[model samples]
Target: MSLSLNLPESLPVDVLAPDALEFDRGPTVSVPVRSLRLGRSPRTGGLNDEHCRMLAAAGEALPPVIVHSGTMQVIDGSHRVRAAVLQGRQEVAAVMFDGTADEAFVLAVRLNLVHGRGLLLSRADRTVAAARLVTSHPYWSNRMIASLTGLSAGTIGRVRGQLTAQTGPVGTRVGKDGRSRPVDGSSGRMKAYELLLGDPSASIREIAKRAGVSPSTAHDVRKRLQAGEEPVPRHRQVPPAQEPAAPERAVALPARSEPEREEPADPEAIIAALTKDPSIRYNNIGRRLIRWLDGCRRGVAECPGIVERVPSHNIDSVAALAREYAHAWGEFAAALEERNREAC
Candidate 1:
C-alpha cells in the first residue's frame, strides 16, 4: 500500500520542504532481524559502535526501524537493526517505506540529519551526502539539498558548482514551493520581450506562457520597453561585447597622455584581451569593472551626438557631472599605480 506524505508545513524558515515521499505509516510490523538488508549509510565512517551498544542497552524500548518494503532494506535505523542483532533478537518492530531505492536513500539522509540521539553525521559525511544528492537529484534546488543534509545553502551551492563542472548545468530546479523554475531567466525575459513587441495586444499570461516566463516577468519586460529601456535590466543583461550595436553614432574621444609607441593600441583589442583572462572574466567584481569600462568606451564614442542633444540650460550641469566622473577615474588609476609600486 502506497502512502503519500507531504513535507510538514511547520519546517524551520531556513529549510525548504521537498515534494511528498511515498511510504506506509500504518501499524508497525515485526520483521525478522536476520532477514533485513543493510542499506547504504550516509555515514562515511560507517555505523558508530558506541551508538549500537547504547541502543542494545535499551532492549525492548528501542523504536521501530524504518525499512523499504520492496527490498526489506533498512532506510533510517541501521543502528537499531544492529542493536537488535546484538541483543540476540529474532525480530524487531519496523515501519515500511514504499518508496524507490533513491527515495529511500534521500529519506535516510534527511532522517540522519534531523533525528537520532547518537553521534550526528560529521561535516565530511554531510558534504558527501550532499554531493551524492546533487548527482542523483539534479533538479533539487540548493536549499532543498541544504535542508536535507544540514548544510548551509551557500555550501550546497559551492558543492553544486564543483559537481556540475563535471556533469554540466541543470536547466531548471525545483524550488521550495515545489515549482520548477529555469536556472537562468534571461532567455525567458528576452523571449517575453520579443513576444510583447510582436503582439502588443496580447495578454501578459499568453506572452508569459509562450516565452516560458512568469506573468510578472512578462509585465516587467513590457514596462521596461515602454519606458524606452532594454528588455532586460543592465546587471542581468548579456555581456556588453555580445550585445547588438546601439543606434547612437560613434565619435572618438580626445587621446590621453602616454609614451609614444610604434603603433597606436586598439582599445577593442585591449578589451578582448582582458576578457580572455579567466581571473578577470570569471570574477564578479572583475566582470562588473569590465562592463563599466565597456560602457565608458561606448559613451566616449557617442559623445558628439550626446553633447549636441544636451539642452542649453542643462549643459553646464551635465559637463560638471562628466568632469566629476573623469576625476574619479583618474583617482582610481592613481590608486592602482600606488598599489603596483607597493608590491614592487
Candidate 2:
C-alpha cells in the first residue's frame, strides 16, 4: 500500500541524506560505535552537555526516544551536534530544520537588525531605514511606519535630511499665541535644530505640534541655537504711557492796585494788574470793577457762577478768568459794536 502526506512547501521533509546513509532500516539498530561526525558545516551543532546528560538520564529511565533525521542540516546545529559528541554519547538525538546557507545568513542578519543589537539605529539611521523599507516592502507604508513608531512623516523625512544640510539659526521669537514671529526665514527653524541634535531630518511641524506651538515658533528656537545663543522664550512688549494735550488758551491775571497803576483803560488791563498782585482781594470796589469790566474779554461774569462768586480766586482763579475771557469775548465784541453804532 502507498501512503501520501501533505506538508507545506516551505517546510520540506527531506534534508535527511546523511541519516539515511548511516541507517538503512525502519527499526532501531544497536550499533557499537564511537562519536561519528553527523554532517559537515559550521551552522549545525548539537545540544549542550547539560541537555545531552538530561536526555541520557531520561533515556536510562524510559525507552530511548527516536531522533528525527529528516530536518537535520550539515551547516545548521553543527555546534549542538559537536556538544553532543563531546558528551561521548553513541547517538545524539536531534530534530533538524534546514535552509540554504545564504538564506540562513540573511535571516540571522535581519533578526539582529530588528533587535538593534548587531546594528545601532540612530534617529537618522532609523528614519533612513524606515524610508528604505517604505520603498521596498509592499506591506509597509509611510503612515504605517509613522503609526507603528509614533513619529510623523515630516519628522521621518527630516531625520533623513541631506548630508549637505547647513547648520543655521531658527527664525522668529515664540509668541503667547504659540506662533513664531511672522518672518519668512523662521520657517522650520526649530525642527532643523532638534534634527541636528537627534535626527537632523525630524519634521519641524511635528516638533512644533509636540511643543504646543506653530512650526514657525519651533523654527525660531532653531535660529537661536544656530546663532550660538541659548534660546529664551519671547513675549509681547508692553506699550508706553500716553501724554495729554496742552491747554490752548492762556490764564488771565487778577487786577492791579491803583497805588501802583492808573484806573485801567480796559478790563484786560485791570485783570492783568489784579492777577499780578497776588495779595489783592476781591473787595467791593474790586467786585464792582470786575462787574463794569464784565463786557471785557477778561471778565469773570461768563464763568461758572461758583467760580465768579468764590473770593479766593488764585491761579485756578486766573485759569477760570481765562476761561471766562474766552466765553465772554464774543459778547464783549458785540457790546463794542453797539457802542460804535451809537456814536456814529
Candidate 3:
C-alpha cells in the first residue's frame, strides 16, 4: 500500500501519524487504572454504563486499553477501563500510544469504529467526530478522514466545506498514502509549464520539484506544452473565482458512455484453456502455476463471502494483509510479463 515518489532528497518522507493500526501492533503492558486520566471521548453522550457492565462480565477476557504514553490519558477503551474497575482489578492491560492529544483522539475514533465488542459510535457522534477531524487534520484528504469516521468521502467533503468556511481553505491535502498533493493542481501545472518554457531540457523530476507537482504531472505539462496545447487540461482549468470541484467529471463521463469497450477475459475461461494445453497439462511447474492461478481466481470470486465471514474485530488487520498480498501479486504478474517479453 506504499507509493514511491521521486521526491527531492531534501524533502522529508511522510509517515502516517500513530493510528489504530499502529496501536493494534504496539506491545501491551499492565498499566494501573488509577494512574490513567480520562481523555476527551468522541462519544457525544459519554460512556454507557450498560456497556461497561457487559465488559465487566467478560472479566479478564477484556482486551487491552489504549493509553497515550505521554499524557497517561485514556485514548480508547474507556468503557473497558471502567469495566476493569468494576471487576476490582488494580490494573488493566494497555497498549501505549506515543502521539499528540489530537492524534490520540483520531485513533480513538478509528478504534471505536472498527472494534466489534463495544457499542459503535452513533451517526451524530461520527459526524461530530468527522467535523473535529477536519479542523484538527485539515490537510488530511476526505477519504482518509472518511475511513476513520466510517462516513462516506462525500459526507466528509460536505463536512469539510462547513468547517473550513470559517477556518479558511487548505492549500494542500495529505492523502491516506501520506503524500501531500496540491488542492488545486492547475497552479502546479502552470508552474511546470513556466519551468519548461525557461528550460525545456530540465528533467521531469527536477521540474516537478521546482514546480511543486508530481513527476508524472510535470511530464504531462511538458508534453502538452510541446504539442502547443494548454498546460492545464480543459477539464481541470477553472475560473479563478470558482473552485475546481469536479475536474475529473469530464474525463470520467466518457468512460461510462463508451461501454462497448472490450472487457477482460474471464479468469475461469483462461484457466480452463491453460489446463487443456498439452505442454502445460503434462508439466509439473506448469500444473503448479495453473493450480495457483485457479486458487487465486477462486479466492477473488469468493471475496464478498470471505469479507462477510471475517470477524469484525479482525476486519482491519485482515483487510491490510489482503491489500499487501494483492500488491505482491501485481508485482509478480509484472515480473512474469517482463520474462515473457524477454522470451519473445
Candidate 4:
C-alpha cells in the first residue's frame, strides 16, 4: 500500500512511505562542511551565480538551509551552502527535516519558486516534468501536481489526459474524484442478485441502484439467474451494504431465450476513450485556461505578487502579451497531448 515515486533511493529517507507525516522543522544545527551532502537539486536550470554571490556576501546572517534528518543531504538553501563554502566556513547552519524523500523534493520546488531566483525551470521543462509526474503518480490529481510544481492545474490536466490516452486503460478503476484504485463491486452484485431471486416482483432499476451498477448490467445478471446459472460475483471492491437474507419463499423463474451478447459499457472507460481525440483535449485545455484567465483579470482576484511586478512602462502592453502567451500555452499543451494520444 506504499506510494513510491520513480526517484533514486540512494538517500536515507523512506522512498515508499504510504503517507508522509506532517513536516516537522527541528531546531537549527551546525554541521561541518565535510559532513554536508550537496543534495540533488530538482531545479531544471543551473543555480543562479549572481544570486549565490549576493548570498555569500550576506554570510551567516541568512537563514539556515534545510536538510533531510536521516541522510543529512541539503534540501533547501543550496546557494547559501555554496556561499558558506566560498566564505571559507567550516560549518553552516541547517534545519533538519523529517519526511519522505518525495515530500523533500516537493519542498525544494516551493523554496526555489519564490526565493528571488523565481522558478528553477523553464516553462517547457516544467511542462515535461509535470507530465512525467502525472504518469508516475496515477492516484494524484491535477491539483496535486500543480501544488508541487507551482504550475497551472490546466496544464497538469492536459498532461494527465494525454498520458491516460497514451497508455490506453489503467487496470484500477477510476472514480469521479479522479483517483484510481482497486475496487470490488462483486459482493454487492451478488447480494442484489440474491434479493432479485427472493422477490420476482423487484424492479431491475431498483436492483441496479442498490447494487451501484448500470441498469443493463443488472439486467444481464438477472437474465443469468433466470437461466439457472449460479451467480458468480465479479471480484471488485463493493460498497458497504446490509447483507441480503435468503427468503424462505423462492419463486421459479420463466425460461428465456439465450442471453444477449451485448456487454454493458463502463462509463469511466468510455469517457476516457472518447476524450482521446485531438479536438476534445484541446477544447478541455482551452476551457480550463479561460477559467484561470478570468481569475487573473484585475477585478476578479486580488493583485498578487505577479501582478504587482508588472513593469511601469506600457502596462497594458505587457498584460496583453501575457494573455496571448497564456492562450498559446493552452493551445500548445492540448495539441501535444493529442499527439501523444494518437501515438498510443
Q: What are the per-model C-alpha RMSD values against the true structure?
A: 19.7, 45.1, 17.8, 16.4
Q: Model 3, 339: alpha-carbon shift in Å?
A: 56
Candidate 3 lDDT over residue span 234-314, tens digit each = 656668576433322123212122222211335764576466434456569979989999998988989988878899999
| Rank ordering of all candidates by lDDT, starting from the highest | 3, 1, 4, 2
> Model 1: runs farther than 4 Å from truth?
1-25, 115-119, 196-203, 222-344
Q: Give the TM-score of candidate 1.
A: 0.57
Q: Could you tell me the lDDT of residue 191 within candidate 3?
A: 83
lDDT of 1 by residue, 209-316 (tens): 999899999999888767666666655555777654322332223344444221222455356545543445656997997798888788788998888899999999
Give candidate 4's error at residue 294 in angstroms: 19
Between prediction 2 and prediction 3, the one with superior TM-score is 3
Per-residue lDDT of model 2, residues 1-344, tens digit only = 11112211232223223232122123432221232234322112223344344433332322211222232233222333343445565554322223554333322222212221111112333444444433333233334344323346545334334321332223333332333443232223333444545754667687676655557666765655555543332222112232122123322233333332211233453354343221223246655555555454533445565465656637586777677876787688678657644533
**Against the hidden reference, what TM-scores do the models get?**
0.57, 0.19, 0.56, 0.44
Tell me how many residue pairs clash in candidate 4.
7
Q: What is the lDDT of candidate 2?
A: 0.37
lDDT of 3 at 135: 91
